[model samples]
Every structure is written in structure tokens, then in C-alpha cells.
Target: MVKLRLKRYGRKKLPSYRIIVIDSRNKRDGKAIEELGFYNPITNETRIDIPRVLQRLTEGAQATRTVQNILDRAQLIAKEEN
Candidate 1:
């Protein structure tokens, strides 16, 4: 199964994440099938590829809770842009 999830990376105290499409059984930081966006919790910042994310979702990619929340925020941003 393919899942949309976060891949953690950065310094010890300051962490950032790349939202990626990866295999469910793979390690958290394992090789990703595709990178969809990035998030920084400290700054509450997010950057998402909306079209690609929608595409992946339509194709049956399941998102974890955190990722789903990020996507929800992204959706609101996208709606406001237009």
C-alpha cells in the first residue's frame, strides 16, 4: 500500500519534514516514490503541490492523520488563492 506521510529531517531540536509518497512497509525515512511538499511545525509553514496531491489521492494513496491535517490546511489555502 502506498501512503502519503512525513519524512523527518533536520537538526536535533529544530525538525522539518518532507511530505512524501512512500511504501507503507518501508521505514519512515526510506526511499520515497515522490515528494509532495514540506512542513515546518515551529513556523507553522507548509508548501504543497495541490494538483499532484489530488492526483495521488484519487489514485488511492492513503494519508496519515498529520498529513491529512496538513492537506486540509493546504486545501483551504488553495481555495483562497482562487
Candidate 2:
């Protein structure tokens, strides 16, 4: 299974994360299929590739809880039809 999750990086006490698509069984930070965005908590900065994210999601990629929240904040997901 493929998952959309955060990969930690940067110096100690100043962490940042790369939103990545990777195999569920792989080690954390081992490798990623694709990097979709970046998040810097210290600086409160975020960058995302919306089209790529949508494509991945459509292909059955599941996001972590934090990533899901980020996507919700960005309003990237379309509303479901009633």
C-alpha cells in the first residue's frame, strides 16, 4: 500500500517535513515515490502540488491524519455531491 506521509528533515529543534508518497512497508525516510510538498513548522510555511496530490489520491493513496488536515486547510479536495 502507498501512503502519503511526512518525512522529517532539517536540523535538530528546527524540523521541517516533506510530504511524500511511499510504500507502507519501507523504512521512514528511506525513499519516496514522489515528493508532493513541503512544510516548515518553525516558519509556518507550506507548499503543495495540488494536481499531483489529486492524481495520487485518485490512485488510492491514503494521507496521514496531519496531511489530511493540511489538505483540508488548503481546500484541495472537492466537495462530495449530495
Candidate 3:
């Protein structure tokens, strides 16, 4: 199964995450099929590729709880923009 989740990166004290699509059997940070967005928890910032994200979501990829919340918020923001 393909899953959408966060992959950690950045320096020791500061952490940032990439929202990625990968196979469920793989290790958390092993590799990714696609990177749909990024999130910086410390700064509370997000950058997402909505079209690609929606495409993957429609194609059956599952999101982790945090990712789901982020996606939902991004969708709401997108809707407001259009």
C-alpha cells in the first residue's frame, strides 16, 4: 500500500518535514515515490502541491493523522483562494 507521511530532515535542533508518498513496507525515511509538500513545525509553515496531492489522494494513497490534518487545512485554504 502507498502511504502519505512526513519525512524528517534538517539540523539537530531544528526539524523540518517533507510530505511524501512511499510504499508502506519501507522504512520511514528510506525513500519516497513523490514529495508533495513541506512543513516546518518550528515556524508553523507549510508548502504544498495541491494538484498533485489531490491527484494522489484520489488515486488511493492514505495519509497519516497529522498529514490528514495538514491536507484538510490546505484544502480549506485552497478553497478559500478560489
Better of 1 and 3 by TM-score: 1
Give me the displacement of residue 66 in model 1, in angstroms.
0.4
lDDT of 1 at 45: 91
TM value for model 3: 0.91
- Per-residue alpha-carbon lDDT of candidate 1 for residues 21-72, written as tens digits (9 for 90 to 100): 9999999999999999999999999999989998999999999999999999
lDDT against true structure, model 3: 0.93
Higher-lDDT candidate among 1 and 3? 1
Number of clashes recorded per candidate: 0, 0, 0
State the weakest 10-residue window (summed lDDT) of model 2: 73-82
Error of 1 at 13 (Å): 1.1
True-structure lDDT of candidate 1: 0.96
For model 3, the superposed segments whose C-alpha errors exceed 4 Å read none
What lDDT does the true structure give each of the candidates? 0.96, 0.90, 0.93
Quality of model 2 by C-alpha lDDT:
0.90
Candidate 1 residue pairs in clash (backbone atoms < 3 Å): none
Instruction: Name the best candidate (by TM-score).
Output: 1
Q: Would you list the rank order by TM-score, best first?
A: 1, 3, 2
* CA RMSD, predictions in order: 1.0, 4.2, 1.2
Model 2: colliding residue pairs: none
- Clash pairs of candidate 3? none
lDDT per residue (tens digit) for residues 1-82 in model 2: 9999999999999999999999989887979999999989888788989899999999999998999998886674345532
